[model samples]
Target: MASRLAAALLAVPSAAAAELPAADLLIVGGEVHDGTGAAGRTADIAVRDDRIVYVGPDGERAVHAARILDASGLLVMPGFIDPHTHADGDLLSSDPDRRENPAYLHQGVTTVVIGNDGGGSPDIAEKAAGLENAGVGTNVGLMVGFGPVREEVLGETNRAPTADELARMQRRVARAICQGALGFSTGLHYAPQTFAETGEIVALTREAGKRGAIYDSHLRDESSYSTGLKASVAEAIAIGREAGAPVHIAHIKALGPDVWGSSGEIIDMVDEARARGQRVTADQYPWRASGTRISNALVPRWALDGGMPGLRARFDDPEAAARLRTEMAENLRRRGGAETLLITRGIGDADRWDGKTLAEVAAAMGSKPIEAAIAILRRSDARVASFNMDRSDIEAFAVQPWVMTGSDGSTGHPRKYATYPKAYRDLVTSGKLDLPTFVRRSSGLVADTLGLTNRGYLEADAFADIVIIDAERFVPRAGYANPEELSEGVVHLIVNGSLAIENGRPTGVHSGRVLLRQPSRGTCP
Candidate 1:
């Protein structure tokens, strides 16, 4: 091995060779996709410590290396960066395996952004510290969520915040940004964020914007749930315009039968915003079904006023119960009837509902779908995969340049484990998206959108976060019914210059870093 490495280094120019220290690892002979949406080129990459030292033509000047990997006939690219995810639940869990995040590593994801949908701790510093101390398999970025900030200042009540409360919320957002939060996120579709008016969102978002943070939103309506899909897109754009922040729509989709063909209109809206010099982008998961709690799918915003306890109380009141059922029935219809809602996770007795459709449960109980839904919710907040999306809509969004790949990974959903590979198979293998575009959207596009430096790219001086895949073997194994299966064909994955996956298996290394955002000048004390 030493003699071969020496012979390879013979071609190096004397001056340049002297400056190039022995690389920790050298990967040679692969089709390199640099995450720029450009065509792949055959090249070699050398890593030392946590940064790439070289990326150029194969075997031209292969400096000395302690370890050399032959990546011939493989796809080498920047490790995927999941722009939106719920993986923090696992990263912060006490379970060691969960912290390792093999499911994601298997999918070739080296970094994940959390605190999405307005649901992360406002204390970015504390959260970052906790994650680093606990150890993680993938680099994690923190986003200060609007949901928690609002919930902290104003309980779960469905009412407008007063001037004082709004100010307090603004302070929290600013503080989080200064403490290194990448940006501010909101899941306006979920309460108590649902109760907030557009102006209120703009007010709080301005805090993040002033600190150079973007606004990532889970639009208030993906279907005809409330503000209507197109209107909701406009509202998000308007919020960003008013707040002076770039707008990013999380898990962008045209959900439900009502908005099945709405992707084209939504794209036009985003295009118009971009044409006017507004920064607008989005992330998408390949799956047709969206995952969420059963109550979130059926319960009306007004009915969720005080949360579960309040909803339970109203379930017993005759008048309120009648009204609640009426709205829930309509919601059920909007979601394509009970048959389309497949329960993926539940609590206690409701656990049996897993892998069963709402319609199936309702049939077994000899109860109406609404009653069955309520009964299940009363027992536990069961999560369901609502298969309401149209394939054409998903494909339409996939082809958009601004729409990058994201998992929105949550438990009981195959996206958590198979999103990246599934995207490769569905989009690239199917010829809908070329390999370069797929890699670009999965990695560089996300990094640029999130303002992450030296990430989502494979270049000298860039972070050594990389993946090697056997293209023919890369495919997703997980499904809605079996959601925990890890993907196959990640031959090697490097996180922070350390091997996290080798030869299609985890190396049990916890080399991930908590990537913190640097506050803009004068933004921090």
Candidate 2:
């Protein structure tokens, strides 16, 4: 099949070669996937400066080059673009190595979208400036987060904002968009964000919509939490409809056992919205367990109104404590069972809980599961790998053309380092999806969804962000037990025309750029 596909590449005119100038680097004789859902073709690509100068057959003979990278017998394509990630913790860190982002570099990800789940800083300009000054390993795109916008105006209280406060929040969103934010994002499932009504979100989102920014959201509910999964998806669509903004769902999934087989229903909702001429898209990771803090998985949002101090105060009150315990027990049941929650990371003495299931920790502590969870949270909010998704549902979403791949990459989860390769192996290699489809979703599709220009494609005038992979070796080594393990199989990687990884090893080059949105014409002053 591979031989047939390669042989089918007929000689086409080298139009780009004739028009382009001399090349700095020429990559030759690779099975190229141009990131447009087209079949693999054996071709050569030429790069001069930060843009791809030419891509055609026999580029070595047509264009003169200073350096030649032999990508023979390898898969060459656009580097993966992750649409949702929590990489801000590493990208903005004081440590230089962390800023280099070796974990994602090895996974073939060239750009990552930060400030996901509504955790984006309200000060997008300041954050972009900081990352620019501090060299990073991959290109970054920023979003104006709803969490910080709400908190900046109305503390972390669980109440609707007054008209004046709502106006202030709207102004902040307008300011962020003008400052080059891609859009407004919301993690409606989290505290503070969870307190906002749909009306409040629409009012604020309109500011971004008026400026032609997208509305990306971590849905208000993935399970039976507050609104059901289907209802929450409807809400997201409605918000986008009312605000006149494109909707991008972050980590779209049927999260817990109670919602295990609901991916089909969720997909239909998105499709129906798209059918109505509404722009709606979503991203999903190829993993059974989703990574999050234990507190977020089980604690009620109202109980966390005043943050940790308020929660501690409630624990001391017998009546409040009893209610909290009852609700927590139900939440635990929704997430499968205590045994399904594996502690992945913790701080101080709580670190001892790593690698153990919540049920196991409860047994060791000689207490009920909810009590054990509270005890662990009291010390430190430990991160957990909650195994709740069903395999059938994952594949159902994977086959959808509108759904792209995102890592939601956070620490303590293998998805941080393995999302791209794992998706390739599971979806493409397993015959669930073809190679072209996989490359398209991981690359060009994401770029289109986010309104990114001149990236996520291997063509003339596009940024030279490319990945060369040994297909056999391109599999994830990371797992729940060893979450930080760097992925294998990327033989070469180029970020903005600089070799960041060569011959399967990092070159320690931080050539990544901080990509900011260009405000639509007639919208910004």
Candidate 3:
């Protein structure tokens, strides 16, 4: 290892290597993938404090180092940034297991974008302060959420916001951006956001645009439920065009049999929008199955109009109850039938139904599958891995230039623990995308999408968030049956220049920082 590292040191121009500041840690003799969809090169990177000071051929003479890692024969790249994750809730947990965030580390992730799907509070400063104060395993970035703001203003009411209420919501968004929120995020498919009209979203996103924040959203409808897949995408594009900020579609997918092969259509929509000078992009998970609640999968949007009270009231009315069952049955069929739904973590009596198919659970309960799903939803919010996406659609969307990779959630599915490595193995290695493109889509592209000026690359003066992987050995160990298992690939992981994982294991270090979105220096294209 020493001799191989010496070769890298000898490879640099002697003059360029002379007289540099001492580095806290030095990585030598690695295949450097700079995260720009470029070819890899043999290079060494020197880190001082939390920034990369040198990223040239020779490092031994370029900078003095207290600690030197002999990273020979490994692929050193910018640590991946997950665009959407549910891990933010775990950052403040008392349980060590959750705080450690082993799943993220194992998959070579050094940064996580949290408060996605409109779940984070609009009080972005307080949330960011709390996580930083508590200390996290990886870098955390907060996206001010629309759900909490709407819930606060409307209290789950299925109605458009009054003009005064709209002004309040706009003020909240502007305040969040000033407080260092990356952008605005909305899960319009979920209530009370579902209650929001298109004009309402356009108004809110316009506020985000004025503050130079991205508009991130979980598309309103991905199936045949309401606007349909194509129209939902158009809605997102319309928001971006009217708001005048870049729009990001969270977890872009052609979900359900009805929407399968719709990725091509989505691409065309984005392309046409781009032609019209609209900045539109998206992120996707590698899996064909998407994880969500049973209630969301079965219940019609109209049935959930007025929150729990309205839903229960409708159930009490015989006519409404009959209609609810009929619509829910159609919704179930649109999801490719109950047999396609796998109960990953069932709740209450449904706990016994975990790891079972909806078809099997329904048989066990001596009821029809749709009826069984409705019963489970009535009892508790059971989660499932719905295997409705087509492989062709997955590949079609993933291969797009505007698309990046993300793990929408971190439970009941292998994606949470294994999305990056799985994408590397299945997509890159399988020739769907080359290694450089894969790294670019996952890292630099994501950073660019979110306007992260100082991260997602192994560049000088950039934040020293890095990953070293033994490509031959890097593989995801997590599976459907064992979704929480740690992946095996990241032999060394560094968060903000501190070693967080070594030799394919965590080093018990919590050196993460709260990364905030930076305002652009000039007008953006």
Clashes of 3: 0
lDDT per residue as tens, model 3, 1-525: 667556756776656555557899989889999999999999999999999999987678778677799888999999999999999757878766677788899989988999899887888778878778878888888898999888888888888889999999988887887777788999989878888889999998887797788999999999889889898999998898888889999999988888887777789889999888888889999987899988788887777877766776887799998998898888888889888899999878888988899999989989998778767767787889998899998899888999998988667889999999888988988988989998999899999988788899999999999999999888988888899888897889999989999887788888988887665444222
Better of 1 and 2 by TM-score: 1
- Compared with the true structure, model 3 gives a TM-score of 0.95
- Candidate maximizing lDDT: 1
**What Cα-based lDDT does every candidate model obtain?**
0.92, 0.91, 0.87
Give the higher-lDDT candidate: 2 or 3. 2
Prediction-by-prediction clash tally: 0, 0, 0
Kindly provide the TM-score of model 2 when superposed on the true structure, using C-alpha atoms: 0.96
Best by TM-score: 1
Alpha-carbon error at 137 in model 1, in Å?
Answer: 0.4
**Residue-wise C-alpha lDDT for candidate 1, range 205-312, written one tens digit per residue:** 999888889999999999998989999999999999999999999999988888889888998999999999999999999998999999899999888899898899
Candidate 2 structure quality by residue, lDDT tens digits, 213-233? 899999999999899899999
Q: Model 2: which residue pairs collide?
A: none
Spell out the clash pairs found in candidate 3. none
Local error of candidate 3 at residue 120 (angstroms): 1.6
